[model samples]
Target: MIPRSRTVSLLVLGAICLAACSSEEQPVQKLRPLALKEQASNIVKSADGYAVTWAGVLSNANPWHFGEHVVATIVGHDAKGAEVVRMDQPLDAVPPGGSLAFTGQASATQKPAKVTIQYRPAQWRQAARIASAFQRFPTSRVQTMRQKDGAFLITGYVDNPYSVPASTLVVNALLRDKAGKLLGGGSTFVDEVQAGSPPRFILTVSGLPKGAEVAKTEITARTWGSTGRPYEDLALSGAVPVHTIKPTSEPFAVDRNTQIVSEYKQ
Candidate 1:
């Protein structure tokens, strides 16, 4: 006859082994930090219906690779600043050096609501499902500014309220336009000040020709990290009309005015 104590001991040992194996059998998704360049396009042929394309800009770092179906969602307040569009769709995974666009009814989806798209591997099936049910977006913001002599400088910070780090990014800035044309070349990118440190880059304003007046300016970041490449965050920007008393007399190759103005003309 089997001993009662022996039976109990075997049952407990089997249960412990089963628990350990169960934990090992579970899968995990690759949640890597990535940055994306998002550009909106009017993919829809007709002007009436809703069709917008969100293109991704793959960078040398954190390239987008396709695996399983990635989900897209947009949530934002309507014109009245009330909750408007809240859309979600399962899109095909975007491979490296690829793009993703969407066409849908404006009425069916949230108009101005913040949008997001997320994904992972098929083994970790829940990647598409956890969903950005949370309604927190990295809002637009300006931290500081510095302009002197012929040099203009800007500083700011962007906060990603998402789970992963936004690696693919484009700082969309209309750098000091003058005479109805863009003046000065500018660069926007993150630089690693120190090894193992995240990233910190500044936007510089330089190279404006003389006699040009500062028209308007705006800066935004295009990040593919968002669930779906969301619209450029205009809300996260700051601009100041500056009058250069010292006027940047640097001539941009003698100022080639479109129809043509060049003291050293060809």
Candidate 2:
């Protein structure tokens, strides 16, 4: 019973109001990008050209989310500030509430005066359980040995804290100086780390500046995948029994008296 033009105008107005209300009810979500905590690079003269090695640490500010499929672009510039070489390094996932230490190598025809790095935004995924259960891979019996060539050989045992077995995992080692500055770093992989049965790993770090003194070493472990499917599956499997302590009300006997000992001669 209304004119056609007026009816069309009222319909358009009603649709705009509905759209405005819908937008108000469901707003777009904004995510914060991952932060680059620290980074370092080394360039050495090679037989053909220059060999470049780089290390970096990516930090996830979100404690309850995992940063997936992050990529780093390394650029090498000559003294003239011209790009000589570039490499795209795909890195592993940054665990929730933790940092990821990664290393890579590349070859350049010309030596670069300095190198720079850039990172791609990571896709965020919320964790199914506590971050510690799936992401925390503990290391023990870690021993660092310095070689005559000024390189370091790091050996250690990595334990599985989840119920699922990790077919493969990456272990990273960072060498620091007395002032807590990173000198160099390296990585290694381990296979078949089962619950209650850990595997041993050996990593080597080299390409440091002359007379560089290493005062300490830092080691870390994580699952090897962009999406961390192994860790995610472990989380869905439920909580694991990380502790072996037995709880009981019954009392146990203990000998508190000290006995005299006799020395034996060979």
Candidate 3:
């Protein structure tokens, strides 16, 4: 038999080796932050009062999680460089390798000449591995009608191709002039969409520059699982069913200029 001290030393060495192997198998994860960028095309105007329209892109740079509770602050400055209005808005979740396009508007009595935007990220957690479970079906029969009041009305249909229901179906439309200059944009939201159901959407935009006509129109649609809880909770509660399937296509980026009819030329 070996000496007692030698046996104790060997046991201690074995214990240390076991601990090192355990740590290697289950490594601690470092927190990854979200990245955001404000689009230069964010529109700010002084209508009857101080009207501000803001838009930005939020990207999830994480490798395996979603960014939730993202907040944005919009500060408006008057011609004299005084703060006119400040407002904070919350954006939707951004999944891994995906980005969210967010828009918000605020109105005050003071007119603003310039506007600034800032973003604040709250939490980064593992997202449901089923990003492909939610999808936007093919939009059908898009029609554009120009009203006498210089407002364009775009009507279309959106379908939910997923087997599970989707919440908060948002449709966004961007209007650009012949030179590819963005004129104005608008978005509409739907509360819920049943599986395999096609819902109709109507988006309208007004106040275009005089003699500016829509040369190109870009439309996109997205759907979320639920906004009430966190993504992790949703996944655990079966709110967002996870699947091994992959997304068939990227988000919609359909362009249609044939349906656009303008009364004036730019």
Candidate 4:
């Protein structure tokens, strides 16, 4: 038989142990589903095979959530519903409250009757809201010049307003006709931009449809964290020190008239 005091001490120790075990068990957090808008935009025949282009936007529903290692799979199917080709594309990261534009290509030996796209998120976590905190650089002296070879050249300067260096500056240009119909699109990536400096970028888009003249052009600029390991880039290094680059829109005519259509707030 145990003494009253000893029995009470044993019971107290057991209760403390149980509490400790409960505290160590953290509940799994279920991330919100990612929204994807994708399609097979263009298909062309090549000597070796047929090339298919897939383009779309991937959005994160949670305003305070961010994800990494997101992958997109493109599957081409034949008339009999048989898989012809499969390609996987990797997206580094998705900003909170904003969407990422992706373009992927796949080559098939035979012509595919239909194509399908799917997105998979490797990991999701609650992240600090920083999508709106990016400082947008001012774009100036935009020009669209037609090359001798028929390719279009879109040139512009981007100024970084943040104190730290920004990496992975991506510039996208969409060429449209007089009726606002998209003719073709091109994108270029800049390695890095120093603080308080403007960098000039030249993007060339080839293979425009025959007799397809570009009447209107739209340009957008965006930047992301370093392509290195996670958190290596200053933008994703920390919540307080990181800054985002807001999206900017500039519309211009192929004849050289430029105007600001709209600006996305950071």
lDDT of 2 by residue, 1-266 (tens): 99999999999999999999887856645666888878888888878899888888888877778899899999999999999889998889887777889987889999999988789999888877677666578899999998998778999999887777888899999888899887779999999888778899998887777688889889999888888567778767765665678977665464323222222221
lDDT leaderboard ranking: 2, 4, 3, 1
Residue 36 in model 3: lDDT: 62
RMSD of each: 22.3, 11.3, 14.0, 12.4
> Which portions of model 2 miss their true places by more than 4 Å?
1-23, 245-266
Across 24-96, the per-residue lDDT of candidate 1 in tens digits comes to: 9557444443233432211222344333323222221213333234554544454677864455645433323
Name the top lDDT candidate. 2
TM-score of each: 0.28, 0.81, 0.70, 0.64
lDDT against the true structure, each candidate = 0.39, 0.84, 0.64, 0.66
Candidate 3 lDDT score relative to the true structure: 0.64
Candidate closer to the true structure by TM-score (higher is better), 1 or 4: 4
Model 3, span 1-266: residue lDDT tens: 99999999999999999999887866668756666643422332454664566556666666566677777888878789999788888777676556667666778687777777787865776656555432334576677777887668988887655544556677777777788765666678765665446788998865455566888766766654323143333234343234668889885564345334342343
In model 2, the clashing pairs are none
lDDT for 145 (candidate 4):
88
Best by TM-score: 2
Q: Sorted on TM-score, highest at the top, how do the candidates line up? A: 2, 3, 4, 1
Off by more than 4 A, model 1: 1-146, 176-181, 191-201, 224-266
